[model samples]
Target: MSGKVVDDRDQLLGEAVGLRQAGKREEARERLVALSARFPQDAEIAYQTAWVHDTLGLEAEAVPYYERALAGSGLSDDDRRGALLGLGSTYRVLGRYEEAVATLGDAAARFPEDGALKTFLAMALYNTGRAHDAMEILLTLLAATSKAPEIAGYRPAIEEYAKDLDATV
Candidate 1:
């Protein structure tokens, strides 16, 4: 692409993202739809399109965009992380629990300290009938990330329980 085309693409993408941030999601979605069609192979456009669709409750529509963004070589590390979480969470909401687990499991493995990924993964695990595993992840997340004074006092116990939720007192 020419520098002019690249500059235009960035400008348009920035406007679409601004719309999304300003709570003009419908407008953002419309702009992104056009942008995606215009720049089919653009990773940032694909990611933004998926994000807009996901925000608009269009999870099915978001999947291909997310997939394309991930497959693209140009996606930045941060956007790649967001795309992973977005796609996995979208799968969960769409009742594709197995896919959700697989996607999120991989994402959590990639970004081990991301609480949000683990939380969503736990939700998917519960959906797929792995309640014990789900609870373990949630409990561990709560123990490790909670800032409440109440939780602070119980962090040690919570950590222990997270390791073995089935253990008897």
Candidate 2:
């Protein structure tokens, strides 16, 4: 790609993210759409476009961008985690529970240090009627992060999950 197109894409993406953060969801989606059209190979733009669609409750529109981002190479670990989690969350929200479970399970395996992914996977498992497995995952995550700051951050939800798990099992 030319330097000019790259620069334009970067500027558009930055503006789109700022617009989304400022509660201008429609404007952000427009900018993201334009960016996606202009730079189809840009993974970050595709991912952000997917996010804008997600925030607007347009899961169907987001799926294409997410798939494009997933097909791209050279993503950082955080971006990979974000894409995986976003896809999983979207699938979960759309009632594709099995897909969410499988995707989040893969993400949890890849990002074992990410407490949030583990919690998300646990939720997917629980919601998919695998409460026992969810409980086991939560217990394992808590045990593993017992001394980390992440444990404290996830403690409240994790504890509530534990109670629900116990009730289910």
- What total of clashing residue pairs does each candidate reach? 0, 0
Q: Write the per-residue lDDT of candidate 2 for residues 45-155, one digit (tens) a residue.
A: 889999999999999889889889888975688988999899888888888889999989998889888888888888888889998888878776785568778777777
Our model 2 lands, by Cα RMSD against the true structure, at 5.0
Q: Which residue pairs come into collision in candidate 1? A: none
Superposed by TM-score, candidate 2 places the C-alpha of residue 106 at a distance from the truth, in angstroms, of: 1.0
Model 2 pairs in collision: none
TM-score of 1: 0.95
Candidate 2 stretches greater than 4 Å from native = 144-169
Poorest stretch of ten by lDDT in candidate 2: 160-169
The candidate that achieves the highest TM-score relative to the unseen native structure:
1
Candidate 1 Cα misplacement greater than 4 A, ranges? none
Local distance difference test values of all predictions, in order: 0.94, 0.85
lDDT of each residue in 5-70, candidate 1, tens digit only: 989999999999999999999999999999999999988899999999999899999999999999
